[model samples]
Target: MNTVLETIKNRRSIRSYLPEQISGDELETVLEAALWAPSGHNTQPWHFLVIQDKKKIDDMSSKTISLMKKSPVDWIQKLASREGYHLFHNAPTVIVISGRKSADPLLFPLADCSAAIQNLLLAAESLNIGTCWIGLSKFLFDVPEEVKTLSLPEGYHPVYSVALGYKKEQLRPTAPARKEGTVGWYRA
Candidate 1:
């Protein structure tokens, strides 16, 4: 396999992380990779909010868990109730990704933002940094008051978050088996 393929195969959603923070250079490199992701009509409507403060990260995790406990989904409530569960998995750094509202109806900022997230994940993996794409943060984002704390620019809304840090374990887990019959071919 080629370099990209190898990296894609090796990348995994890391949940356990060391308490030590990632280097500034590494974070910057990962963010830069996100900025290069393809966007709809080249609008490039993504914003990144990097939070390195331990207190703030922990608070966010706590708040998110509180909200999750009220969720109708049984699994979410159970996960939230789990002892020692942290929304960001206690990573030293958390990044919130937002997408700018587009005037054009055809443009989908969420898709663009998702592409940026994938790039961010791949870049972090390439640097041997642990990362987890935090969809659970959406619980916090749904709350207007919680989102106001982020102070995002006008017309931008939070879409996803990523937790980043050094892995607690040096050994990488093997990739899980992929689902079968998911691919289709259309050849002329």
Candidate 2:
């Protein structure tokens, strides 16, 4: 198999990570890939916040769990009680992806930002860095106070957050079988 195909096939969402910090160069490479992702009409609507401070990351996770505790949903409440339930899985760094409302039409900015996130994930995988897109913790960024704490600019809204670190586990699990009928071809 080709190298890019191999990378794509092997990339996995890593939840367990070592305590070591990712080197600055590796972080830069991943961010660079994000910056280069294709955007709608070249609008490039995404903004990234790279948080490396463990204390700050922990506080964000705590706030997310706190909010979860008040939810009417049973599953959410249960998840909040789980032991060792840090939203980032104790990863050393997190990159928060956001989009500006004015960057494009309502949906385009989000689509562009999502493309950038995929680029970031693939780049990290190539660098032997582990990444997991954490949708559960995005609630932290949705709150008015949390948005202010994140220091996101006016008009910018949180789309997603990703945890980053080096994998602690040596053996990566193989990819599961892809869902059938998820693809189709157009022929003339």
Superposed by TM-score, candidate 1 places the C-alpha of residue 165 at a distance from the truth, in angstroms, of 0.5
What tens digits encode model 2's per-residue C-alpha lDDT throughout 1-188? Answer: 98788878889999899989999999999999999999888989899999999999999999999998888889998998899898899999999999878733445887899999999999999888999998887668668888888888788888899999999986886678899999899999
- Across residues 62-129, which tens digit of lDDT does each residue of candidate 1 receive? 99999999999999999999999999999999999999988899999999999999999999999999
Top lDDT model = 1
Model 2 vs truth, CA RMSD: 1.6
| Local accuracy by lDDT, each model | 0.95, 0.89
List ranges where model 2 is wrong by over 4 Å.
Answer: 103-107
